[model samples]
Target: MTESDGDQPTRQRWILIRRSISGPDEITYYLACAPLDATVTDMVHIAGSRWKIEECFQSAKNECGLDQYEVRRYVGCYRHIILLFMLVQAFLAVMAV
Candidate 1:
């Protein structure tokens, strides 16, 4: 992929993985940036983990009000996110009992 940063164009190598067992419509395409020697297994693993990561963020947003904040500063936003994660961790710990 080529992206322009100001005036210079930077090129990045992206790998496309087509995962499907049935038809063309059922195919899942994954575009990822990885090493030239990276295998299909590595790309698949990375793609699979994306769902879990998104789920965790969604859970945080839903249960902890993680997305409800309106902070103007970077440090404030960072602290708010950290606090939300701490709250989530505590909630999980209590539920595990």
Candidate 2:
């Protein structure tokens, strides 16, 4: 429901609770819950997003050598990544538009 700051990725969390009843005369009920409340479909979405990001990381690190930039200064690094992202955004916009 909330977007992460800047270009940072979003994180998903979920929790689930379930109850079961069994036995004879006196039925006994037990509760089982998962820490994450998300359903199977939601989990699949999270996993797919993670995999896509991982693929991007691989492409950037291995193919583009994104981290190989010679910018050692904080400002330089920030500017470099920002420009790279901007270019990517522009490219996407052009393609979509």
Candidate 3:
């Protein structure tokens, strides 16, 4: 598929739909590539795998001070994230001991 960008037709992303077995709601997804071996179920499964990582991020923000920043500068934000992640790692290490 192509998208009109000025005078050229650029590559356009296409979406796939997956419906729940028990609910009327559906999930729409897009892939960077269409692998020959992957089916719709595989695509959905792959997409759903990110939820675990997302939940982990949420847990860090909620419990480990991952997002507890009040800085406005870009460098300050970066520093906050780096420092907070290090602090979280230390906390986890102490917990494991």
Candidate 4:
């Protein structure tokens, strides 16, 4: 970071990958960030698996109301999470029969 960089806000560096071989008209780009010491292969793996992680989180939230919490206390929050997980499991079990 430079002197004028305002406190080095980044802990990782971002890189962009453009599919140049696909030609400009058919081009696609993927942007991702990784630690400064991370290898290209490690970054590639992280970028590749990112979609699957996101998909699982989205499915959990939508089907299980995982993001519907409104509790403030720590214990309340834990209880909500535990019950919600159990409810989701029960739903999956019922559907399997």
List model 1 lDDT by residue over 1-97, tens digit each.
Answer: 5555687655445666565657756666666666546666777778888878788777777767778867789897787766767578569758979
Model 3: CA > 4 A from native: 1-14, 18-32, 70-97
The order by descending lDDT is 1, 3, 4, 2
Ordered from best to worst TM-score, the candidate numbers read 1, 3, 4, 2
> What are the per-residue Cα lDDT tens digits for candidate 3 across 1-97?
4456698655454465656678858655555444444566766777778777677677677777777756678898676775677678668858979
Cα distance off (Å), candidate 3, residue 51: 0.9
Stretches > 4 Å off in candidate 4: 1-12, 17-37, 71-97
Candidate 3, clashing residue pairs? none
Per-residue error for 30 in candidate 2, Å, reads 26
lDDT of 4 by residue, 26-86 (tens): 6545655555566778877777787686776576677777678666788986767756766
RMSD of each: 5.2, 14.9, 5.4, 6.8
Poorly placed runs, candidate 1 (over 4 Å): 1-12, 15-29, 74-83, 86-90, 93-97
Which of the two, 3 or 4, has more TM-score? 3
Candidate 3, number of clashes = 0
What are the models' TM-scores? 0.58, 0.37, 0.48, 0.44
Clashing pairs in 4: none
What is residue 17's positional error in candidate 3, in angstroms? Answer: 3.8
Shift in Å, residue 48, candidate 2:
1.9
Residue 15 local lDDT, model 1? 60
